[model samples]
Target: MGTSVGPSAGLSPKYQRLIQRTLRIERQPKLELQNERQQKKNTKSLVSDLDGKLSSLQSQLSTLTDTTSSPFDGRNASAAEGTEGFSVSADETASTGSYSLAVNRLASEDGRVSQTFDADKSNLSDFFTNNGAQTFSVDVSTPTDSNPDARTSIDVTVDSDGTNNKEVLSDIQSAIDSAFQSAVDDGTLSADQRPSASVINPTSGTARLSLRSQQTGYQGRLSFSDSSNNLLSELQVNADQIADDTQGGEITEVGTDEASSKLTSEFELNGLTFTRNSNEVTDAVDGVTMNLEEANGTASSFEVTADEEGAQSVVKNFVDRVNEVITFLNEKTNVNPENGERGELADDSTFRRLSRQLRTDATRPVEGQPEGLNTLADIGIEANRDGTLKLTDEDALRTAVRENQGALKDLFAGPDGVATRMKERVDQYADTGGLLDSRQDSIDSSIDRIDDRINGLDERLQRREQQLREQYAEVESTIRSLASQQQSISQRLF
Candidate 1:
């Protein structure tokens, strides 16, 4: 039992040629394994690409299916001409009606400015003789309650670090913000109750401390008071000019606050009166927020209507994603132009089914919608000859949405809608542990097996090569000894 092949009885055996032939035969399996590995890699990549496109299509479909979001219930609003002081947002709850808005006085924040000083040169030592806790309080009066009576007044104390004027002002601002935030945290004051503080250096080359009510309108009127007169006076803020809620006044300009007493914003809508401390009123209308931009006593008309931009965007995205998936399927399944090589999943049946399913879902008519609104075609979306979805007429779609939004909504995202069905179908191919996942796992496993066989073959080939070399070396030595013996015997005979 010889372990190796025939060794030449001549000068030496042709071991190189034998090893080459044997190795060539043995490496066939390894070569095949490598090719299979590459094919599997390409297949996995194809599946992965399909998965991403399908997932995106599903997400877009989800947006259309979630009817509770009122995806089609968009709102648009506009103020009457010559109106500069207000804006509005109309939602699902807003009616298709116009309102005559008369702003008796636009709500303004209780605001005040500091007397001026030189920012670079001034220090806290000039104002406060002692670097201790100095207290400042904010008083707010609403229709229900007035502050400075403890509950409505937010008191904050600033601890002077005995630093420069800039640091002093900054510390004061920080302390005020912290106090309000603490109140909000403790449920003492609402988040909106916070006051704002800033250091203003006007052209006077002097720095002044500016303080204002964080809130707007009459209730947000600010009144500044210091238990220590030195605090307000040194800061150069006028404590005497507090705004009184009883006197309603309008500012001719934006920044000029004549008094410390801030005026509450007063406005009338549809002959109904409304009063708020701030110009920005959230509760004025149901599902509608009112921002009193200006107080024009004259009637300013605003109309609330549906905003179609959001719904239109969602619709556009759905079409684009459908086309993307179609393009991917077309390219992957077709042969490459440059090399004439087919794609990894060119004959993939599962991918073919997935592509056909998506197109069918998009073209299918939604159940329960009107005959004119049930299908994607009815909503101005049509399939082209190339099997791609196209919004054929944007104006028609927009008109459809504007006129019968409910019908369009039902067709796209209703219980038996096109988007919903498409999403569900996509899930079969792209979801976790779904068809694509199974396919990818199978590919990865094949690659793993090929790698194992290739490694084993590598070890076997190395051993076989060494054995051939050793056997041929021994054959060469034997031939050398035989030739020497024959030559010596012939010489003696002669």
Candidate 2:
């Protein structure tokens, strides 16, 4: 047998694989395209990070710029140690002052209990539904007599099918609650003036109806009258159980005489006494709300001061956010001097420009600020050598917040101020359709283009590979035929 020179003559599986491998070498070089894509992905990631930092910095600045809610305008109220009977708080409008406070009484809600009835045996529905009368009305009057006619009335309808005392009492309670809630929803009754009814059923004993006013103190006194039925009379809760419903159909008293003291809050501020119908008193002092928890005869000192710590915290947070943006830009835009290694964004001029703008705005003096309160440096927020902020002198910041808060706020949050300008600049990059978005879109488009080019190159390479396979097959067949003719001639000559 003679050796054949066809493509399959020595083309074992291993040899065929080698040929295929060699053909793959002729395919397009995608290393550069792949590297470019990776670089673009990295840039996009960095840009996203930059966008996030800028957005955070802008949000921190917004808080400072809002005059109505500026942290610098905040106030704090502090009561002297060992002070009794009260807790107090102050808002931005509170005056910074010291005053003596004394609480004589804490206001309470008005409540009344009906006569007891058998829990399971007594049937209240029969009494209430007499003469087909199944409806009742309740009135809640104002604490002051200035407007005697100023009262709210709610009508309750009883459920007729209730069988026992407890069931009937529960139905009446539900009806009353529904009526009052409906009045509130319909704007006929104020929520504070709405009364409540409950069926008080004790275990192994009798049941009773409990009527209470939601409003604290005298304002919460309740009165009952027959509308379509004598529901209150049936329960024995009317006619001076607490007090007779008089004074033009409004009950002036609903609780026992001893409980009357709890109907109004009494306190003294700066030796001047005051009384109110609520334990939480907001009108005694401007911008100050005091909660009288209990009554103590002794007076105690309370101080209202500027919330320097709160303002400091806001300032510190702003500074920290600013530093984060600055630091991120610095690191990404930095180039190592020793190794000449470039950062992710070192070649981008936009980030470098933003970094400079942020640093300049943070450190620059304001246009209209007074000399003593001109710059952040004056308030102890100073720039480090690397353009980051540091709270160098916390005491200085506190003093500024304590004494010159308005000017300090103006320095950072005022119109054309540091935070205002920085925020405006950041918005150009961080907002939708802004610089970062545009840059991201451009990078994505470039990546798409590269992918398209790679795909085209691959298609061309696949076609070329197929052509080479056909050409190699033809060459192998010619070689095998020539070798066969040479073998026949050699054998005939032998």
Candidate 3:
């Protein structure tokens, strides 16, 4: 049979598919490079996590080594029955012992108030001293302290129509409060030591003004006077009314006056007499700051003891941090058997060495412990099958700390200790110019090269496509020409 060819017949489909398949094959290396870059990124992130754990452990270890924060040197104070008002805090230098404490009295400040007046009716302006003087002064007695000036006298000037308006009782109170408030804002007077004023029985014509001490002790008593005015007399403030009040006296014409008198605080500590300007006693006992609340007929006492719970908490934290890093490393360096999925760092020899070193350091004995308890297991921390650690017995750990405090501090903070070695190990991978950084850089470079090669392949494929299209068109033209010639010959023969 004679064969007839269709005009629509074109280049073979397999030929077109051949180059596309080659392009896919060419892209395989780039895809691999992208995946490797991702893996390196994951490894770097895990390294940072491990570094943080190491840093935390180091910080915790510092608490045990520092002379100011050592748990072995820590002490806690407890108030006995009826002694709850006073609380205490101690540092590492605090000596451990029990002492009987008594709150004989708390410190206090001086307070004073002016005599009442009928603002609308009484002629209160006539109370001023002889020479139209409207100023007054207060004498304060706090045990003279070197710093803070403990200003002995405060000057209060009346705010009025400048000697024209008739001043009332409330006007004087406002002026006094204004002066004290200014002192407080200037930092000269402490908030607790600042004076306050209030109007008692306000509506009554016989309303009285009262003042009390801000500091709770006797040294805080206050007395009032005016160099040439009757300000103190009008306010009914006298030395006897304030319990321990004293004021300047013998004011000469435009000259100075006598010095003010002050008082002190008295109390008993453990039947030993102690005196202080203020009721808060700090130096009486080492590392103990006692704030006396009140005097009681029955004596109150408290005790100081070693803090075992604090020490145990520190050790437990150490164990958990160790387990966290170890477990993370193990997970990152291992392949899941069920899924057969390899981890990012599964075949990395450097990470493998690090993982193995981590295991050894955690379980191995440290070189510097004097009691031969060099390993974490000696302090009740032990590793499990899955590379995690647990506190096997908490009591045993506490006993180790209390019995061997010096040894524990040396064991963790010493030259060849677990924390020191682990810190160095983390630095190898996580620090700048470390292995992890270099590995990331290498992967990044490979990915960049893969991208460049991909672009090059695209350009090459475009050129090949252009050449193939031209050759196909030529072949088609020849086939069409041969068919036309055949058709002409057949028609003539017929």
Candidate 4:
């Protein structure tokens, strides 16, 4: 018998796979589209980064452009040692000057304490009718500039079954607090018009109830009377006790002058005497607040001046933001020196032009400014070699902020000022519907189109692959027919 060829002959499966892979590799359009998509994505990322930097720059610009309540208007109050009678603070509206203060009296809050009671032995229910529930009223008077005698009253009902004096006092204290707090919540009484109640056990055997005003000075004075029961008289904290105490009686009165009953803060500012209802006086001096701590009756010297450091901080922060935006633009638009590859935004004309314009805006001199305080260079901010800004001369900036504030304002906030012009330019590119947003939208659309094209290419590859498989199937059939014929011929010849 002669040897016969098998039907599984000709092209091997491994070679067929190699040929299909070669054909797929030659489809260059899909690979090119993928590369383009990556480039666009990088460009979009750079655009987002630049947009964030521009927004930060705009916020810093707004602080400089604001006409009212700016850092330029800041003021500071300074006092020497041994002037411990009062602490002072000045605002933007305060004038730069020296002030002399002498404190005669510091305002105080009104308070009252009941006579001591033997907690274990005393039966506080006797104040009521044989330990029955008793209802009494509390009157709080908070005087104000508009109303000298604003009084509010709240009635509290206490039910105590205990014979211990401390426990009964605690019940009364809780009732009083609950009543006033409820009045405050219902808008019947303001918070300052409410009084605080507490029961203090100074000794193990003795306990006393104390009530204090929420406010300082005479505005917080309090008085108690019996509403349905003689609670205040029995507690020995009524107006009669207060009067007798004020007239050299045993019950001591806190926060009230024995001679005049004038619970006010009396101090002399700038050699002129003035009195305020509260120790924290704000209106006595324009834009200056004086907080009285002691009644030393000694003069203290305080100086109010422009806040140079505050103004300098504002300027430095503005410069830092400007540098950030400028540096980002430069980096995104730069070209690599080694391989000559363009950066993410190298071809973006808007960002390229913005980079140059920012440098010009940051360095150019403002019109109508004086010789020494005209430009950013004059006020200590200078451009670096790469076009970023730096605060180089702090002393010059400080002098400009303190002595030449008007000219400095003109340099940063005027019509043709550096900060003003830079802000306008950045807004055109970063604001809503601005150039950067439009560019990003256009890039997104292009990416979407690329995705569609890639999908079409994938479908075309699949169809081509199917056609190649059919052609290879025909070749396999022909090989099988030849192998069967050879086997038949060998048998016939034999």
Q: Give model 2's TM-score versus the native structure.
A: 0.81
After superposing candidate 1, which stretches have Cα over 4 Å from the reference?
1-14, 80-83, 111-212, 221-262, 271-273, 334-343
Give the local distance difference test score of model 2: 0.78
lDDT of 2 by residue, 1-494 (tens): 12334443544455467557865675426656888889999999999988888888889988989877888889999899988888899999999999899998777676766667788774575665555547777888644458733666667777556677888778778888898899889878777777777876655567777777887666556667765555666566665634332111113343443335447777889999887778898888999999888797679989999999899889889988988999999999999999999889999999888899888988888999999778888888889988999999899989987888778888888887898898899889988999999999999999999999888777776666555555666676787799999999999999
Candidate 4, which segments miss by more than 4 Å at Cα? 1-11, 81-83, 114-137, 141-150, 156-175, 185-187, 190-193, 198-209, 224-236, 240-262, 336-341, 490-494
Candidate closest to the true structure, highest TM-score: 4
Order the numbered candidates by TM-score, best leading: 4, 2, 3, 1
The clash number for model 1 is 25
lDDT of each: 0.72, 0.78, 0.62, 0.79
Q: How does candidate 1 fare on TM-score?
A: 0.72
Q: Candidate 1: how large is its RMSD?
A: 7.9
Please give, for residues 395-429, the per-residue lDDT of candidate 4 as tens digits.
98888877877788878888888878988988898
On residues 320-375, what C-alpha lDDT tens digit does candidate 3 reach at each position? 77676677778777889999997666888787787778777677788857655788
**Candidate 2: residue pairs that collide:** none
TM-score of each: 0.72, 0.81, 0.77, 0.82
Error at 432, model 1, angstroms: 2.3
Model 4 scores worst on lDDT over the 10 consecutive residues at 243-252
Alpha-carbon deviation at 124 in model 2, angstroms: 11
